[model samples]
Target chain A: MFDWLFRYANPARFMGLSGALLPWLWSAALLTLATALYLGFSAPPDYQQGRTVLILFIHVPAAIMATNVYACMVVASLFSLINRHILADVAARTAAPLGAIFTLLALITGSLWGKPMWGTWWVWDGRLTSTLVQFFLYLGYIALWNAIEDETRAARICAVLALVGAVNIPIIKFSVDWWATLHQGESIMSGNLAGPFLVPFLVMMLFYMLLFVCLWLTRIRTLILERRLRSLMGAA
Target chain B: MNFDLSPYGAFIWPAYAVSALLLGGLTLWAMARWRAVKAKLATLEKT
Candidate 1:
């Protein structure tokens, strides 16, 4: 059933396949992002939040992608731990910086939004704090990977760290409910956000996810090429 | 395009700007690394 995925798991095969797919992915991501950004101007303002609701367009998507990208990294780390192949390690390693950027984007955008509405740049609210922790987790994972010289050993240890950090994902998600937090409850799926706000917001979310995939794939391909170059140099 | 994000333009603009800068910078870095490595690998294999 998953043979297609497994078939391309080999670095050579993955290069052949992803090379064919990446142009399309990049184009689609850019086109949709342009559409979403344009539509954003038309997204209706909140009666309570006013045009400040505009912040929600970028903030919510970056926040969601921050957690989602980390989750993807965890899955890649699992594959890295279980399999002998280096492709999984390449994936998990390549994704760390991207995830860190997304997490950073989320935190900064959230801070920008918080100041006007919450009257403060930040608070020790559960969700905000956990998300901050998530950013540090991403940074730590990257630093740990770079600190170690041995690839295989670094892969295994970092995989374990990613697995341990997986516990924080749910905490970030449900922190609003579990603790009285200034971060509002999830409104995207609960039919709470108005239609005008919802459409552009959802499109922006799609744009962010697509952008993440395109960049992630590019980074993975770069790592694979770097590995190939290393082996060629060693052989020479 | 909507410059009328007034009353809250200060906050809204910065949020968008930050996201744009970070995401854009990452995209450029990824593309550059991929291109550089791909060229180097090609040169290596040609030899």
Candidate 2:
């Protein structure tokens, strides 16, 4: 079952495989994203929120990706810690910037959505504050990775941080329920989302996840090349 | 087909604008890094 993973564990082989997949992945990502954007913009506005509802398509997906990507990193961190797999570390490391960018998008877009509705650009409510903390966790993980000199040591330390930060994911998700604050509780999974809102929002969610995959693969490939270049330079 | 923003376009547009700026910027940045690294690696492998 996992045989393919082991086969591609070799850097050179992984490079060949990713090289073949990326062009197609990029094409799919771009095409699907375009479709999602069309659907999102054309979708009818929420009855109460009016056109401000358009921001929800972007904000919801970005917020979902922020948590999903961090979850992925935590899993990768665990794999790296236990098996000491080199690519696991690479996977975890390459994902941080993408995660951070998505988190920032969520923050900004959430604020944009909140202002007309909530009458403020920023708030210190539990959901928003915990998400802000999630954003900082991403930055801290990236900084920790760069701060250490030894790659192994950095991976070990950063993996621990990533795991510790995993606690915040649930906190972010449930903050609304826990605090009854500004953020409304999760609606997408609760069957409260209207039918018209569901489809485009799901497509946008797909688009965001696809974007993450494309960039993550490219970054992994880049790291492999960088490692090979360093080895070649050293040998010369 | 005509699409109406139904007001609140101010908040709606900038949300997308920032998303595009950040996401697009990162995509281009990653591709550029890939190109530069590929070229440098190719040059080194050649010599």
DockQ (CA atoms), all models: 0.82, 0.77
Estimate the TM-score of every prediction: 0.91, 0.91
lDDT of 1 by residue, A52-124 (tens): 7678788888878888888898999998888756888989998888888888887888888788887888866
Q: Candidate 1: misplaced stretches above 4 Å?
A: A168-192
Question: lDDT tens string, model 2, A154-228?
Answer: 888899999988976676558644664444554321112467878878888888988999999999999878877
Runs with alpha carbons beyond 4 Å of true place in candidate 2: A1-4, A168-192, B1-3
Sliding window of 10 residues with minimal summed lDDT for model 1 chain A? A184-193
Chain B TM-score list for all models: 0.87, 0.88
- Scored against the native two-chain complex, candidate 2 gets a DockQ of 0.77
Best by lDDT: 2
